[model samples]
Target: MSAPIPNRVHYHKRDRELELGYPDGESYRLPIELLRVYSPSAEVQGHHPSEAVLQTGKRNVGLLNITQTGRYALKLHFDDGHDTGLYTWEYLHDMATHQQAWWENYLTRLERAGASRDSGVIQIHQV
Candidate 1:
């Protein structure tokens, strides 16, 4: 079966979801943080399975920009300075379908590595 093509794409800043509407009356709301963690770039996915990097501390990440790349994909520029992942239609569909499982796996990995979703360090200034 062929992957469904997206008819409309809407990024909700407040909700932090990239909503994709398909012709088959289905819509997927992909969270910005999940998209950032599951980025398909070499920096995240790596060249080999063994070299894949586990993305941590991105619970509060947001989308900075989204640019269409040709007719097949969109380049997502994240607020955390990551702008390399080209999210293809098929890739998005796959991610949307298996989001729950993948997210659970990510949480497990984080727990094992003692990583926090809050990647940013805030400096407190006392007057």
Candidate 2:
């Protein structure tokens, strides 16, 4: 399939989601937390898989601002002072499609690392 182009983008603050509407009458609501954790920026995803950072304590992060990047992406300004990720249409589409799976995987990773979604919450496991 050709890249899924988004015809509309709406940020619902009350629900904490960014909705993407497609020409095909399809839409997906992505939580802000999800976007933060899976940011496409090098700071989050890193230069390589092995260098990727595990984003934790971001359950309540909000989008402070959003600006389009030419014709391909949007630069999201997160409330936590992160404003680097360029969320392209293609990247958003892929994330929307695979949200559940990726979210579950992220939860698993957090659990393994003894981290919590609540900001600054980390379990101290006795060695």
lDDT of 1 by residue, 98-124 (tens): 989878988998777767777764434
Cα lDDT tens digits for candidate 2, 1-127: 6567788988999888999999999999999999999999999989999889999999989988888899889888999999999998888988899999989999999999888899867588898
Give lDDT for model 1.
Answer: 0.89
Backbone collision tally, model 1:
1
Clashes of each: 1, 0
Q: Against the true structure, candidate 2 has what lDDT?
A: 0.90
Residue 85 of model 2, lDDT score: 90
Which pairs clash in model 1?
57-117
In candidate 2, which residue ranges exceed 4 Å CA deviation?
124-127
| Model 2 alpha-carbon miss at residue 35, Å | 0.4
* Model 2 lDDT at residue 43: 95
